[model samples]
Target: MQFEPGDRRRVLPRHLRPAPAPEVFAYAIRPARPADLPHVREIYNHFVSNSAVTLDERRSTIPSWREKYALLDRLGLPFLVAVSPSGAVLGYAVAQPWAGKNAYRYTVEDSIYLGPGAGGKGLGSALLQALIEACEQRGIREMVAVISDRGAEASIRLHEKLGFVEAGRMGRVGHKFGRDLGTVYLRRALRPSRPRRGALFGRSR
Candidate 1:
């Protein structure tokens, strides 16, 4: 089966949907919508301004993020969000091309972020796991995470717990927050027991 452009169906399979959040934080994880972009941008821009988790020097605007979100939709990639029962966005995760060239079509890069009040509550894990499962369903073979070296042990450990392995580390490759920063690259393989079927990257069979 194939998904058409702009399909609003859930990106993850039923089996991959995360279990209910703890009573203290009831939330649902689902594919992103245009209305969610403002909250998503808020979470991401927080990282952009306060941490090295993302390398963006300038904060992202909603308009730019909208373009990115649409591109991912056209590419059939997953961009998911965790939303509270009250409609607050707790976190988001996305899968993008590892490289722009066609040779890297089978590989993707993942980015995950949570709101300041949402960490250590299992939201990140749940979001990333769903993203992984969605990519697997789409016939992707590998997922890579590029993490900042400073204060990144938690991020590294989170990825490791999810079965990703340290692939490489680029030393002092980025300058941010008035200091040189390094980056850690982690990768996870997603090939399943049965060979994948259907089209990838929006290519028809």
Candidate 2:
């Protein structure tokens, strides 16, 4: 996918556009690079340490995340970051296979995280919207979000704003920070499956 000037605006509909902020216009969304691992790890580790947003119990190391980046590259998946004009990593988003089975090939699970002081400015929405477009371009038929039930209203609202619907909820399936946490599942269909062509007049192509 191409990343051009003001492409973020083009990718997001007007209603979904984050309200203008001091850094909003100064930031651009683009694919993640190797150098971004430190900042990415920082943002992710924040959630791991401070919140149940992610079920990960340990902080992610640079080397470990580097392997993750490599796997995403190997699988041709979308791993994007939102960067400021000064090149600070504001936030990031990624899409991974929802399941490893061949039957789940057309589906993907999305994860998004923003750095401290980056919330409520629409950066999260922008990053997620861009990720959705990238996944759709790659022919992904469905997108899913697995969100923690504890104080994740913003994340849930973001997914709903982007057209995802609540598919299911798992009650107290996760244990984090000495408390049981439930998970909310949201799903959005990217596109309808193409109808398979039947053999014409009993002749296979």
Candidate 3:
């Protein structure tokens, strides 16, 4: 995909524009790198400071963010980012093990975050679809998304578009900023992959 300079959020960085332009908004979903932390954190902090997308209000530093990637990498989890032709990060997506038991090994929890300017575009869906592909490649069978109340509609709509169904809704489960937030669980079952021969190692596996 190719994005014109004016179409993307920020000035395209030289390294990020690895391709030519296309008719649609030019953006690509790629494996996230440690060097992309700053741009990723900027978008994430926007959600943290201004919205209930995340329960955390504390700001994230590069070190803390890197720690998260390290943990995910160690667990063979998926962490991806959406970047424009100019290198601006438009969004990020990830999946984490859903539970600690062996029975839960095939299930994973997923999340998607888009930068402020990237909303309303196909970016969110692209990020999610990429995450879904990553999970499918890794043999993940079920994926769950716990969405904040305010994001329920958009999240549900996206998940539905990707074949997810509403699993449950928990009322007043989390309090952030100054209001109570409801959590909605959306799930999608993926095709099975090669079975593991033995138990996997990890606290959340």
What lDDT score belongs to each candidate, Candidate 1 first? Answer: 0.85, 0.85, 0.80
Question: How well is each residue in 50-80 modelled by candidate 1, as lDDT tens digits?
Answer: 8888888999999999999999999888898
Between candidates 1 and 3, name the one with more favorable lDDT: 1
**What is the TM-score of each predicted model, taking all chains together?**
0.82, 0.81, 0.78
Q: Which candidate, 2 or 3, would have the higher TM-score against the true structure?
A: 2
Candidate 3 worst ten-residue window by lDDT: 196-205
Model 2, C-alpha of 181: deviation from truth (Å) = 0.4
The candidate 2 region of ten consecutive residues with least summed lDDT is 196-205
**Residue-level error in angstroms, candidate 3, position 191:** 1.4
> Candidate 2 residues 1-205, lDDT tens each?
6888876744678989898865224477888899999999999999999998899999999999899899888977789988877899988999998888979988999999999988887777788888877787777889999999997889999999999999999999999999999999999999633333221111011
| Candidate 3 global Cα RMSD | 11.4
Off by over 4 Å in 1: 1-23, 192-205
Q: Which regions of candidate 3 deviate over 4 angstroms? A: 1-24, 194-205
Superposition error at 9 for model 3 (Å): 36
Instruction: Report the Cα lDDT for residue 73, model 2.
Output: 86
Clash count for candidate 2 is 0
- Regions more than 4 Å wrong, model 2: 1-25, 192-205
2 versus 3: better lDDT goes to = 2
